[model samples]
Target: MNERPSRHVIRPSGCPGLLRVVQALDGGICRIKLDGGSIQADQAEAVALVAERFAGGVIEATNRANLQVRGIGPERDALIESLLAAGLGPRNPAGDDVRNLMLSPSAGIDRRMLIDTRPLAEQILTTLQTHERFHELSAKFAVQLDGAEALAMLEHHHDLWLSALVRDGEPWLAFGFAGVPLDEPAGRVPLAQGHALVVAVLELFLDLARPDQNRMRELLAEFSADEFVTLLARRVPLQPCPDWRRVASTDGLHIGIHPQHDDGVFVGAVVPLGRLDAAMLRGAARLAREKGDGSLRFTPWQSLLLPNVRADNAAGVLARLQALGLLVSGDQPLAQLIACTGSSGCAKAMADTKADAHQLAERLHRRGQALNIHLSGCPRSCAAAHIAPATLLAVAPGRYDLYFRDATLPGFGALQAHNLTIEALDHWLDAHPRSPLDA
Candidate 1:
């Protein structure tokens, strides 16, 4: 940990953190950010213990590859202290909210990855926390580092994204602002200058943006991205990324057995509807310690991967995960469903989305149809950072409006029905069986 130290100044944010517990309908919630989504077995165990002891034992796997403990009670200070003792806190209090860097769950081990990404990610993360200027970034402002992994989450939006690529046998990083790596890169830089590029981009953003423009997208709405890039070029050398587009890889690799770059395999399982009780998390941690590399990597897909597991033990690991109430296969109905902290937790929720998601899962299970679905308690869509193939937006306690993802449409996409019950939605799915909702 050869990182520079920064001053501690608590920034005000509505988002929950290990130190800042935001109150919900259920109780208080504290988010514990993981460095590139990687957590050790002992750290996982410690989180489980604190959740059970100080909170309500309800642990949520966030869409950003982080974890949050819900229903935290009066022992909030104790919970925070316990987590800080486990080395889960940021280097300084001001660094906590700005440490929002995302990497593929299979970052270092993905067989298809062009670069390992861990080393650069380490440097970037250290700077994000230790550099005081970056502390002014909005809690939601994020950055993504792509190693061209086959199992990457390419759809999620980030303020800045850097992806690995090669040009004439030399490695370079294709970068973009206010969008994902899947979009055409704004520019490119030598691999060695990636860190410098990020610093320059952030500093330039801070210099040009007004106080109200906390996000890159917000600032870009008023200022041209081209102009911003021009200013950034003065700080860091850049090159044009001509006619380069990231290749879309296969999906659903976040579940079940997947081979790593090494001979070992990674066992992945979805935390059913993004909710994990203490027992479930502890069980997964125990399995990681016993059968894997004594570590677990949480994915942006609301799933966890036990990396470096022996290929021979893949089946056993999958079975054990299933026994722990995790959805181990892509075909599992629960695996395809994601719900926000609905009425049962969040005060802003219009319906109990988690409970309804279970009902929808039961209906789909009977029909043997598995589709990627998202149930949001409101339009805020806290559960899904990106648009899902199908979305059930709650209008009332048990009624919802359904939307299918359409590339041409915005928001939730094309609305198909309004104020339909779960049963009615099931029947509608049966009617339009060939809809793009399967995506």
Candidate 2:
């Protein structure tokens, strides 16, 4: 347990949450964990203001659907206080790291949702923050609560995943460990017991795991999920989810106008390569204040949406989003690419992943290849939570080792190329045009 650096409960983590500003090669990074990726218009504007004033104005929307202000300086504490003042801090000071519950951006309003997950998600988030024991959990430890939303992100794995499903005509949450909702659930619980199940799982993890085993997957590496669930039964009610298949979500639901379960509409837009300038953020905030509900919800796909928009004005909102340089169409190749802060900003980076991704995007656009590509500076793969269809792991200044996603293999799937330039990658991609990676 002393793997923790010091004799303090809230030990400093390398990963920055709202309260912590971690030092990076560029500057201090202050991560703002949004509740289910939703931020009120005023809160968004406050973020814009603080970022511009206290940081270098390089704001990043993380893959997990949160915001981070990069290039922060000596004014880090003031910046943190300003954000906290804006109601962006965790429920408890010690609970900041443990508040890693993720929900679908379209949780309540998605057309295909079987249950409204926001209420349950809110309860879980509150418990994760307010519960003192969970404060010791890793900041990266995360949970996914899915409502069978058509706009859900199924690829990004989580420590624990709970997906809505029907059992004998009643709503139940089919849950799993260290995987996505698409994976077979280890068990199920009634909608009412959802929070208790999460609490039990987290408590069991804390009880059974050493400090090094900060994640559910790490604990699972030594203990089986069956064992964990069996132990969990002693603490909370557990029911086997015999017949549950998480419904497949639509791919393009993260962009353009989408009809909600109700008569309202939602306008979605991609943030070109997951990076947004001050104006882009402020503009989105203004739009959120004006057209739709006065709130914006970011998605794991590195995009955002204005949910509960009036059906009549959805088209106009989409056009305005496009005019502001957000990608309103999913067909755009650049929209599919994700690149981490490369050599330009990160000391660990070899090649510039962001710049390389741009070049790769141009090549793919020319070849009419539609693929989900992730460019990582190092093995950390900071930009992508899951192994993308294609990955360019940087090995040198301008060279990278390419890998294609293979489910059977671990860690970036099957290695394709040793070290290739962007030009060489284009050739390889051109050769394998119809590969499933490109589909």
Candidate 3:
């Protein structure tokens, strides 16, 4: 706690970052941000070692497709040092917090990509970090770059989102403010101008926004999008985009074996409740080095993908990942479950979310059900960036209130049942067997 990243930095947050460690009920949590959710095999092992040695070995694959080390006691400094040694820290110390850029896990390797967004993403990330003026931005003020990858996460909302599009059969990137690619794009720019567009938008945001207007949406709340866009145009050129919508991709692309554009395959797996032990990660790292192309990619679904594996060895690699306690197959009930850190970790938790989620997974598994289910510790659905089809909001230690997703209703959709035990939830789930909450 003494080694604060910045003097102006806010006091102990539940939100973890590389330079800062957020304290929880369990201990301090340190988040390690990956470049496009891609890390080398050795880096994965480093995370495993530090998590197991200095912390509680509870490594979480975050919804942002990053890694978080949870349950750190007084040895926080050592853990941080290990991660830094592994080259996981930000480029500059002051730039650490604002380094929030999300790229598709399959950015360059995906067969359906229009452009490889990695180079542009790198430029943006460097600018976000080194630009001292941008340091004032909130850690949650994220920007997503989509390369039109078939395996992309389009549902997560961000302060600024840029998605690749083809205009007149030429590659262009369409951008929107405070929305996802799935939403209509406000404007478009040539692929070459993508980085400049991001820079202009961010600089304009910093210049015009007040202290209270930390996010783009907040600034847009008072100032019209056109007004903001005009100010942005003063810095860089932007073309008006029509009513083109982003093509939706398949759900559950983060599980099992997947094809890559290159001459190989990538095996994906999920961590139960987004938490994993050192052994599991280390085993994955070994598989990545042995069978894959020595790199692993994490996804926004709180899952891990071992990319660049030979297609011939993919089955064995997946089998190895499964043997290491990873949920490789999509049919597993646990694979469909996403849960936040509950009473065992976060002080605000109403239930032991991990334990309760395990019970739910077991019950649903017995009933042969598989749905996108999110189990929040409390009202804050931190485990998921987007609302899942079904949610169980914890009300007590082991009781929950269930809700189904209804686009018409706000906040986790409409409430279905109140104060139901795990067993009762099982029965309710069984009764609604035909619901896609199972599909």
Q: Give the residue spans of candidate 2 off by over 4 A.
A: 1-10
Candidate 1 residue 57 Cα shift, in angstroms, is: 0.5
Cα lDDT of model 1 by residue, 1-439, tens digit: 1111232345567888777888888988899999999999999999999999989999999999999999888887788888988999998787899999999999999999999999999999999989999988899999999999899998999999999998889889999988898898989998899999999999898899899998999999989988988888899988898899998866989998989998899999999999999999999999999999899999999999999999999999999999999998888888999999899998889999999999999998998888788999999999999998889999999999999888898899999999999999888877886777643
Candidate topping lDDT:
1
How close is every model to the real structure, measured as TM-score?
0.97, 0.95, 0.96
Q: What is the lDDT of residue 7 in candidate 2?
A: 20
TM-score, structure 2 vs. true? 0.95
Show the lowest summed lDDT stretch of 10 residues, model 3.
5-14
- Score candidate 2 by lDDT: 0.86
lDDT of 2 by residue, 1-439 (tens): 1122122245666787776677778888888999999999999988888889988887788889999898888887778778888899888878888888888888888878989999998898899889888888888899999999888989888999999988779898899989999899999999989989998988889999987898889999989888998999999888887777887888888888989989789999998888887778999999999998899999888899998899899999999999988988867888889999999888999988888888988887897765688889999989999888888899998899989888899889889888899999888877876766756
lDDT of each: 0.90, 0.86, 0.86
Full-model lDDT, candidate 1:
0.90
lDDT of 3 by residue, 101-167 (tens): 9988888988888889999999999999898888878888999999888899988899999999887
Residue 196 lDDT (model 2) = 90
